[model samples]
Structure formats: C-alpha cells, structure tokens
Target chain A: MVAHPTRDRRAERREATRAEILDAAWELARIHGLAGISLREVARRIGIQPPTLYWYFDSKNAIYDAMFAEANRQLLQLIAEQEWPTEPREMLRMAARVWVAFSTEDVARYQLMFQRSIPDFEPSPEAYAVALEILQTMRVDFAAAGISDPAHLDLWTAVVAGLAAQQTSNQPGGDRWLRLTDEAADMFADHVLGTTTQESQR
Target chain B: MVAHPTRDRRAERREATRAEILDAAWELARIHGLAGISLREVARRIGIQPPTLYWYFDSKNAIYDAMFAEANRQLLQLIAEQEWPTEPREMLRMAARVWVAFSTEDVARYQLMFQRSIPDFEPSPEAYAVALEILQTMRVDFAAAGISDPAHLDLWTAVVAGLAAQQTSNQPGGDRWLRLTDEAADMFADHVLGTTTQESQR
Candidate 1:
C-alpha cells in the first residue's frame, strides 16, 4: 500500500505537539519540583488554551503518566546501552554509580519515579513494567554477586536508594552520599557475598 | 521571683494553644498530606479564624518548623528510652529497626524531617540541634559496633533510611524492606566492622 502523505503529516504534527507539551512540563517541573506542575501553566507555556491542551491530553494526570513512562523508558534505554562489569564487586559499584547518577542527574524525574512526592498519582501499568525491568536488573546484579535472596535484593535497593535519597535531599551537587558508592559496594560484596566468595576461593 | 497563679495559668494556656494548633495541623496533614496543609483549614479545624491562629503560630511555615522540631525532639526521646543491643551485629539490627519504626510510624513527620518536602520551610536551629543529637547517637552506636569512619556512618544512614523510604513509600504495612534491616545491619557489621571485631577478639 502507498503511504498516505497527509495522514503522515497529521501524525507528525500530533507527535510534535505531544513532545512540545511534555517539554514544557519538564521545564516547569524542574523549576517548581514535580508537585509544582500546573497544566494551565503548561498550556500557557505552549501557547495553547487549556481546552486545546485537554484535546491533546485528557488531564494533568495523563501528562504525568506519560512523563513517568517516558522517564522509565529513557532509564531502561540507558541501562541497556551501558556495559555492566563481570566482576561482582565492580558490578555493584557500577550499578550503584548508575543509580546515584540516574537519580541525582534529574531531580524531578527521581521524585516522580521513586519518591511519593505526587498525590493520587500512580504510574500507568506500562510505566510500572519498565520500572519492574529496572528492578529485575538489580536482582540480576545481586545474583551475579551470589547474593540472590529476595531479602538481599530488598536490602540492596534500600542501601543504594538510601544513598541516592541522601544525595538528593541532604546534599544535591555534593557527593555527601555519592562518595560512598564504591566503598558501600565493597562492604556489600564483602558482607553479603564475602562468605560465599571466600568459600569459593578456598 | 515568686510565680503568680494568674501568670502561670496564662503560660499554661499559651502552651496548650500551641499544642492545639499543632494537633490540628497534623490532622490536616494526615488527611491531605504535608503539602496539603493550609492555615485556613488548620484554623477551621481548631475553631479559630486564620488570623487568630497566627497568635499562637506566626505562619504555616512556622507551624511546619514547630512540627519538625517537635518530631525531632520526640525521636530523640524515643532513642533515649530505647535500649540498643551491645552485641555489634545485634546493635545494628536494633538501630535499623528503631530507624525504620521511627520513620514508618509517622509518615508526615518522617517526610518533614528526612525529605525536602516543603520548599520554603526550614527547621529552626534549636530543632536542628535536636536532630543532630539523633545523628550523634548513630555515631555512638557505630562506635560501639567498632566502626568509626565517617564513610561508614554515611553508608549506614543510607542503608537504614533506604529501608524506611521503601517501607513508607513503596510498601507500607509490609515488611518488604523492613525484613532486610537485620541482614543489612549484618552486612554493615561484616564489611565495615568485621575485621575490627576479629582483630579485637584476638
């Protein structure tokens, strides 16, 4: 079948409008934090009336859902492209650095995806699947280190997430917590996987 | 100077009014979240006009400051009353459990203190002093466990706080992260303190 030029043009316009609205939302969110996003302000920034904004997205929440999914997709893409270390300890260090950088590099994105900053906002199921994939990667990292229990996964998330939280909250642009990534990873490997590693070495 | 009965009564009333205002604020916070708290709604709940509410507290931010201090003071008291285990590994478990409970028991209080939830609200120095005391206690516990480096202190905080954040935000009323506190503490002991303990035992 021949491609329809007008339909393609219309589709391109629609996609561009969505990207425009999302870009405006990201800007507003960075300035005011994720919870500060206002659809009216977003529409105003886009030079569209609120009704026109609604035509593209049904509600402020729909835009948030899109943003969450997009951020997750971006994160998944980043993880896919990056090479994880084969060594268990180095792998955790790399993973920790990635988690901290991923969170600290984008404050609003971190808040939306990790923190309960937004009220009555649940990421769409598709978005959550992406998040699950991110978590699955962590489990794989833990298992590679021979720390594969569910408890270990939970502990690892807490350990790394805690570092990210401290960096973001207590000292943004500072390595107050980020500085500990490698040492923490070493401690994790030593304590959580040390006995196993030692026994295997024996 | 001798205390006058009427003056004493007036001071009592003032203290009671401050408590009343804070209580009202907490109720509103629980219902609408920390950011949802409004001076008008707080005043309305307490049967006072918004301006009249200012007699006890200067502003909504002032109320938040008081709540932050009060929560910190309460946590300090809780830490004081609780007995931490003397055994190095068990001590960490105690510390992690205490930290998790302190946070998960009151989500609003935890958010206010640990998270940069309110944009403009800064806790007064007096309250911050109380918060420092709590952190100081963690160092003491770390010392007791034979881990004294500042990096270990930073990592321990991350490990425990991450668990609390997961419990509060990701899975409240669940032990998903809480269950890992002991294991995490053991990891801390092994990696951060294990060698020291072994050396001391010799």
Candidate 2:
C-alpha cells in the first residue's frame, strides 16, 4: 500500500520534534542533574508548552530512555570507528584512549547511561543488547591480543566502568582529578598489556 | 592546663553528638542519594532543629567533609591491617576482596568519600599523607611479587575504585551488571599476578 504524502510528512515532523525535545532534556539534565529535570522544564527550554512534549514523549521517563539510547549509540560508534593497533599493549592503549575520550566528551550522556538511578525504568532491550555488544567487542579484542584470562576481562570492564563513573562525580579538584584519571588509565593499560616504558619502568 | 570536671564532660558529650550526626548523615545520604539530601532534612531526621545543627557542623559541606575523612580513615586502616599472602596472586586476590568488602559494607560512606562533589574542599594534608602511604604499601608489595612496574599501582587503584562505585549503583534485577563486576574483579587479579584461572580459560 502506498503511504499518503501527508502522513509521511507528519511522521518525519514527529521524529524531528522528538529529537529536539531529547536534546533539550539532555542539556537541562546535565546542568541540574537527573533529579532536577522535568518535562515542563525541558519544554520550556525548547520554547514549547509542557503538554506539547507529551505528543512526542509519553512521559519524562520516555525522554530519558531515548536520551540514554542515543548516548550509548554514540559511545559504541566511537569505539567501532577506531583503528586498533595489532600489538596487545598498543591495542590496550587504544581502548583506554577511546574510552576516556568518549566519556570526557559526553559527560552527561555517560552519567545517564551509568550513573543515575531511574525508578521503574527499564532500558529497551536494544539498549542492553548494544551495551553487551560493546563489552563483547572489548572481550574479543582483548582475547585476540593474548589476554585469555576471564579474570582480566572482568577487571578491565570494572576499571573502565569505575573511571567512567568517577568522571561524573563531584570530586574536590578538577585538575587533580583529570591528572589522576589519566595516570590511572595509563597504569591500567600497563597492567593489562605489560608495556615496557620509562613510566612503566619503576 | 587543668580543665574543670564539668567542662570535660560537656566536651566529651559534644564529640559524641557530632559522631552521631555524622553517622546519621551518612546513612540518610546513602538511602536518599547525595543530591537528594538537605541540611534541614538531615537535622529533622536527627531530631534537632536545623539551626541547632550549626552547633556541630558549619554547613552541609562541612558534614560531608567529616564523613569523607572518616570513610577514608576506615579504608586506610583496613588496608594497613591486611596481611600479605606468600604468593603474588593470593596477595592480589586478598587486596581485591578487602577493598570490595569495605566499600560494599559502607557504600554510603564510600560514596561520600569518592562519588559526590564537595566544592572548596581539599584533601587535608594528613589525609593526603595517609593516601600516599596506602599507595606506597601497594607499590612495595607488587614489587616484592616480581611485578616491578609502578604503573600497576595506578591501575589497581582505579580497578578497586571503579568496582566500589559500580557496585553502589547496581540495582535490583541488575544481575548482569553485578556479574560483570565480579568477573571484572577476577580478571584484574589475574592481570596483576600474571596467572590465569579456569574462569579465564573460557
């Protein structure tokens, strides 16, 4: 059956509007945190009445779901697009760099995916599936690089998640935290891949 | 200088009350979350007028600082008291267990120390000194185990910190996240000790 031109246009408009609302919500949530956000606040930021947002999103949680999915998608895309090195040490370094860069660039997005608690909210199956895909990719790459231990994978994932979470917290000093994070990442890479370098040379 | 008996009693009572307030704040913060808490709410929960809270803490940030210091002190004490194993692998495993267990038991306290932001607060010179001592101990142990790289210290710290942070955020039906953390910790231990176990065999 041929779709009507008016219906197709309405569908496109609806999608665009949804994206606009989500973008607004993401920015507001970042500034005020997850608890500080509401549908009315998001709509106000986007220059629309609060109820108009309901047309596109069923509720604030719906918007959160969409925002989270988008953020995860972006992170996975960053990892996917990297040109990984063949050496195990270099591969590990590349993974750390990608992970840190993605997290630093999208602090709010990262928080939504990992930090905040949203009551009664279940991420769409697709989101969890994609997250697993990212983890699996890391697992496969690490294994191919001769990291055949299950324990190593567990540690790697935990450390990576920890660093990501740390980026979102209200730590005391910004410069110190950044230095610590970079130093920590470098150390983690060495531990995982056993790279030989002056810094690694105790 | 000799103090009066009544003065001594009052001073002791004040110290005890302050400890009670800090303990209550830590518990409430954990349940309601850091951002969700207010000074008034904390005071109310402790059965004191909000203004009276100032008799002990100058502000909520001050309370947070005390809580953070207390948590760090406990963690450092736990780390200091740990008995190193004869084998490097066993030592690493023990360290991971102790770190995870400490953070798990006092999750709110851990969050206060590492997870939340406190503006205008710096780690006291004493706290900084103790933190360095803990790192030094870790470095010395790793070196003795033939893991000569000092970088491993940073990686291990990040791994432990990350695991603590993630476990705090894990929710009901978050079995996948929990399993991932456990696996990650095991992998980290193997990476540190240069040993592979059956779990890593897969």
Candidate 3:
C-alpha cells in the first residue's frame, strides 16, 4: 500500500481525534457510571456537536468497543513492561499483584474490561481477540509452572479476578483485598501444582 | 407492641404491593440491565401511577435497596433449605454449587447484589445487614471445617464468585464455568484446610 503524504497526515489527525473522543468518554464514565456515558456529553466536552461524533464513532457502542480494545492493549503493554520472575510460584504472585493494581486503580476501566456491565455492549471480535490473547499468555505462563489444565486455568482466573472484584467493590483505593494477592496466588499454585506454599517458596 | 387487626391487614397489603413492585423491577432488569431499571416502567408494569411507587419506595434507590435485601433474604432461605452434608469439604462444595446456580440463574440480581453496577445506589444499612449475615453464616460454616482464617474466607468467596461471574458473563445458561465449581472448592479446601480431594472424599 502506497501512502500519499497528504493522506498520511489526514490519517494521523483522524487517529488523534479518535483518541480524544475516547479520552472524553472515559472521563464521563469515571464521573458517571459506564452505563451513564452519553455521546452528547462526550461531544460537549470536546466542543463538538453530538452528531459530529458519528463521523468518528458509529454509535456509543462503537466508542465502548474502541475503549475495550484500548484497555486490553494497555494491559498487554503493561505485561510486556514487567520483568517476570523465573520461579512459577513467584511469577503467579507477581501476575496477581499486577492484575489487582491494574484493576482497582481505575474502576471504570476495570468494569469495561472485566465486568460486562455495560448494557448491550459486547466487545467487537477484534477487541475480544486481545482479551483472548491475554488469556493465552496466562496459559503459557501457567504451563511453564507445570499447571496446564483448563479447569485449573478457570480456577486461577476466578481467584485473581475475585481478589480484584473484592478490592474494587468492597474497598476501593484500599489494599485490604489487594493485600491478599500473594496468598491467593500461592493457594492456587498449591492446589494446581500439588505443592504447599512452603515447598514452592523453598 | 400490640397489633391492631386493621393495621395488621393494611401492613399485609402494603407488603404485598411492595413485593409486586420488586417483581416488576426484576423483570425489567432481566430484559434491560440493572442500570436500565426505571421506576416509571416498574410502576407502569404493576399498573400503578408513577407517584404511587414513591409511596412504596421513596426513590429509585429505595427500590434497589429493597431488591438487594430481598435477594439476600432469598439466599439465606436457600441456605437454610439445603440439607447440608456432614463432611466440611462436601459442605463447602455444596455451598459453591448453590451459589453458582443462584447467581448465574439471575444475572440482574447477581449484578445488584455483587457487581455494584448501579450508579448512586448504595444498599441501605438494613439491606447491607442481610448481606453481612450471609457472610457471617459462611464464616460459621468455614469454621466448622476448621478453616477459620480471614484470608481463607476471602479466597473462598473469590473462587466461588469468580466461577459465578465467569458463567454469567461468558456463558449465561451454560455450565462451562459452573462445572468447575466443585474443583474450585476442592482446590480452596486443599489450600486452606490442608486436605487433598482424595482425603476429603474419604
């Protein structure tokens, strides 16, 4: 594909506008609940007519899809940035900490990415693919620790995601739930790996 | 306090109307999301003027509070009705199965009771007290199994609730996530109670 200089500049500007729109939507979602986000408010915040949003997003769900994809991409980037521990148990604990922190820090993003709370908004296949990739990465990580069962994977997600849920719902901005990340991870490791926490630590 | 016959009848009638309103709200919530529930629609469904609803519920949030209390009360009844197994491990697994079934069967109630998805609707102290009772019951049951640690309780709730969340969000009306409930219970019991599935079974 040949990119004309004029077209490339236009594409860059379009991308920037799209990013700005997502930013506004997120701000509104944070203030109001995710279900409370209005395209009109998003446009107003950006100093544009509500109808102008259609040029960038077909509908509110489209904006949510983009946000969904963006959130997962951010997660993937965060995972990449981490220097993962070599030992499987320590690695799981590290992953759990990262997840709880990531989820509780910005609850609106957490709800969009994890809770499926938004009415009638299913993440597009493109966006959902990113989520699947994150799971695939988790699978590989678990397999490295000699834990590859599908049921085990489900249990692991529940334990970690549960911690995130508890933290976000029961005590936002508090470490009461997040502080259990290591114990939860170790419990999971012990169950799936058939080793005790002391053994894993050793 | 002595109860007058006329006042008792009036109280009974009011209680009946309140139940009807909650039923309508749940129906709407099932069709629409929890956040989508409207007092006007709920009133319309039960063939009452919008203002009449305010008589029963001071506000939309008040209706949500009643529903929250109702859901937890239902859970408590279900717990009481169950013929609990004598073995602590079996009892825990049984509790997990019961929770997954109850939660996944009604996504709206699950969101209201668990997800905290409703904007500006905090469960009243009266409603939240019921939830605390359920947790206390769980504490007693776990204690019977000699798994009395606070961290263990958090881990247990996370594991079971995770299964329910996965089933509801990923596979509503499917047992894909629910099927892992027993395994998850065992995994948790193993971690906290120091008992393997094989030993637990015996």
> Largest lDDT belongs to which candidate?
3
Q: Rate residue A115 of model 3 by lDDT.
A: 85
Error of 3 at B158 (Å): 1.4
Proportion of the native interface contacts kept in model 2: 0.42
Instruction: Count clashes in each candidate, considering only residues at least 3 apart in sequence or on different chains.
Output: 0, 9, 0
Q: How much of the true contact map at the interface does candidate 3 reproduce, as a fraction?
A: 0.63
Name the 10 consecutive residues with the lowest summed lDDT in model 1 chain A: A193-202
Q: Per-residue lDDT for A58-151 in model 1, tens only? A: 8888999999988998888888888887767778888888888898888898888898888778888887898999888767766776777787
Model 3: per-residue lDDT, tens digit, B1-202?
A: 9755656777889999999999999999999989888888888898989998878878888888999999999999999899988687788899999988999999999999998788788888989999999989888887887778887787777778788877787778898888888888877777776765446556
Please write out the lDDT profile of model 3 over residues A116-144, one tens digit for every residue: 88879999899999998998888888788
- Candidate 2 runs further than 4 Å off: A1-3, A29-41, A50-52, A83-93, A116-126, A136-150, A162-202, B1-3, B38-41, B83-94, B117-152, B170-202
Give the per-residue lDDT digits (tens) of candidate 2, residues B80-111.
Answer: 78777856666767877787677666655665
- lDDT (Cα, 0-100) at A133 in candidate 2: 81
Off by over 4 Å in 1: A1-3, A140-145, A195-202, B1-3, B195-199
- In order, what is each prediction's RMSD in angstroms? 2.6, 6.9, 3.2
Candidate order by DockQ, decreasing, is 1, 3, 2
- Runs of candidate 3 with Cα error greater than 4 angstroms are A1-3, A196-202, B1-7, B196-202
**TM-scores, each model vs. reference:** 0.92, 0.70, 0.91
